[model samples]
Target chain A: MKTDSEIIITLSDVWKSFGTQTVLKGINLSVIDGKTTIIVGPSGQGKSLILKHILGLIKPDRGQVLFEGKDINAIQKKELNEIRTKIGVLFQNAALFDSMTVFDNVALPLREKTVASESEVREVVDEKLSLMDLRGSNDKYPAQLSGGMKKRVGLARALVLNPRIVFFDEPTTGLDVALSNEIYRFFFKTQEKLKYTAVIVSHDVPKIFKLADYVALISDGVIQDCLSPEDFQMSSNPIIKNFVEATMGTIYSSEAMEV
Target chain B: MLNFVEKLGAYVLYYVNEAGRMGIFLFFSLLNIIKPPYNKIASVLKQIYVIGSLSVFVIIFTGAFTGMVLGLQGYNTLTKFGAEGLLGSAVALSLIRELGPVLSALMVTGRAGSAICAEIGIMRISEQIDALECMAIDPYKFIMAPKFIAGIISMPLLTALFDVIGIFGGYAVGVGLLGGNAGAFFSSMQSDVEFIDVYMGFVKSVCFGLLIVWLCAAKGYYVHLERKGGFGAEGVSNVTTSAVVLTSVSILVMDYFITSMLI
Candidate 1:
């Protein structure tokens, strides 16, 4: 795990709402460089919203979203683009460009954002594709790829730019157990090779515990707890207890209600 | 009575809100067009395809039929005064001055305008627009500018083609098919129609094209958030429908004023 001095992202008292419904409330968190931080929460608890805010896709209704200790909201459009060039996002459904091929999808940001020569883009794309074990399927469209392959292709695209921060929104959703494990392994290997900060949002508790150095649990529009996985595992909070036990369909105590 | 008035009032408010949103989108699009990060080649080519090539056949077909009908009808009206030679001139004047540009604009509005809105609307709903923003790509420069340039370029060119085809159709019916002297028919058309008529039509087509593309793209992009609670395919469909209907009506309304001033 990386040290606190290398914190890459910080959200201080952030709040976001959609009309009458508040998605996130007073959320404060920090993501450290070269370590994976997993955000685990119940469904519809604003995990995706938080990820969107971090990516600067949506602004917070109030408070600051700082990347490398500078407020991102105040940056102009051109400056924002520079900041965005250094970050990669993996959406829950792997929002691959439907108009582009697998190779083109991975090459899009490189072609548009950077001044890389054509050969450079080809080499980088091929290298990322090989890293993701997607070398032979470069010509395939997103629709042609399997769910696991789509996730991997998404990861390849995210890593193509070699971003300082990589965000995964439900990386293992709708995948089989074996495929999900493969995704986690790819994630860990990718982090080790690249040494970038990874902020992952998932409900996969076992995998999250295995991969995450730090975990944040959100519930009812607020972050309930942010702790190390081992500390989180040993905590006496019934909410956390219900969540961990519910995954295995086991009750820790007769008195504890299901989440 | 009160319920009917309330419904009418709600409809008015809805349309007003949509117009406001569209106005904001156009403001941003215009700003982006004058600024840097251009993507000039892609923008110009997309406009050529979307506005120009796609609209050609529809304009030609509509123009040919309209001219033929005008020739046939004008011949009947002028025959009572032994003025059958004037049929070609009547068709040429009506088409070049008004019907050609207006009808072509309406046709392209239905075909290209609705499509622009639907495509952009679907992207907005699917978070493709958000994806572009995250990548630091301006949605306006990437999406709207090409459509805007295409709309302006395509409409005037299509209107010009419509005028030419409609006049040819009139020539076929009035001179070759109708047993009128080709020399007399053409002489009347040339003598009656001025370059000012063509210029006026071109101006109207340009204005109509801008309005249609701006209104459609703006409505689709902005309406996504408003429909977030119920956001889905249905929301996108509703916005697309509104974009088409609103653009069509606005084009016609603006056409009246532009024509009056030109005349």
Candidate 2:
């Protein structure tokens, strides 16, 4: 939707498959800068696979994942790491380090990546956890927290570095509707302050789109539609129509309202 | 028939790949150990605590019993040969050259090797490893090198402890319980058991330490997730089993080659 916007990453003619099943087939997509691009898809579809390519976690069998005009596959290890520092990812499972407490888990990036003093780390961690509504849970371990709390802590960790971009994998998974909306508002407020692009993939279609500047739906190893939420809701494609209908029961477009 | 050949070929290739991969892993882990910022003192000590200190009781238990059995058996055999004065030499040589290192290796393999495999494998499946990569921390250097360095340092120390305890256990049984002369037992041991025998045990202990820690970390790191026993809890368990079994058998097999060469 933001065609003139600067693109952070582009997947051109990319293809991937697992064993006998093809997951991504000749995909072409671009992520606009400073805006939220929600990659909405069915469960077990190639959304995570696409996210992996963007993060340079996995290379496509064909084509390329280009980040800031450089092919992630062709970049040297040092160069790739330089690119990685600018990006943060929230995995589907939160993936907190079990050996460390919640405080240590969030403090890991600061300790590992920066030369900040212990007091500085404590101060940053305190602010981030407070923003994520996880101030008092620092002493607890990841194993003891609920899924939603883990997701919040993961968000805090991701934002602690204030990377230029962050990827959220199912950020609203276990939380109720109210909590998901509250988390979204919190994330937006942080985004407004921090000014970073975010790309998220979620199955929580209707509620998740509330934060999206663009919604891209992938199915059958191809992206079927990439449009604004209103345009996506009015997509003529049957797959998108069925998905939107199933998740929303009924769809009304702003364009239709304008008409 | 073609399918069967293809399957056989694939299995063989898989093993060859794994072998080559393990070889590279060992090389890198050891290489990173010497080349670095050199600030792993805390991590190395933590590993030593796990690999050396925590494993004391088991090592001592194994050493004591092996020595007691040797004392009884050696005395019985030497008396029949009219060489009862040689009992201490026989027990000392046996403990210092073979039982001490081999039993310590096996016990450490069970106590520490399986644990290293499970911990690394769990980290892999849970995306903690990926998180480390995302954070630009090399899991190999950060996670594995300490285990290797600690194992190399601790195995010999543990083996020496085992040897000492076994000899004492032999003294307890032979000199106090049995009718062997304490002077002959202690004096004969002092004269007959040279420094070389104890040196051989130390060398073997170091080798076993390298094999156990390296193989366990490699197995856990590269446990193939695409295969049935390659992901999740089942995968970690399977890899841990293989690491312990493979490392134990490897130590035993290499012990023969090493002994053959040394002797």
- Model number with the top lDDT: 2
Question: lDDT tens digits, residues A1-259, model 1?
Answer: 4455788888989999875898888998888877788999989899998988887888999989988877888888677788888888888888877667999989988887888998999999999999999989989998899999999998998888898888899999999999999898899889889988899999987667889888888887777777898666655787776676775355433333332
- What DockQ class does candidate 2 belong to? medium
> DockQ of each model against the real complex?
0.61, 0.67
Best by TM-score: 2
Q: Which candidate comes out best when scored by DockQ?
A: 2
| True lDDT of residue A23, candidate 1 | 85
Q: How close is candidate 2 to the true structure, as a TM-score?
A: 0.94
For candidate 1 chain B, the 10 contiguous residues with the lowest summed lDDT are B222-231
TM-score of candidate 1's A chain against the true A chain = 0.92
**Model 1 chain A lowest lDDT segment of ten:** A250-259
Per-residue lDDT for B110 in model 1?
86
Tell me the fnat of candidate 1. 0.50
Flag clash pairs in model 2. Answer: none
Model 2 lDDT tens row, A62-152: 9999888899999898798888888887888888989889999999888877889999999999999999888799899998998778888
lDDT of 1 at A201: 97
DockQ of 1: 0.61
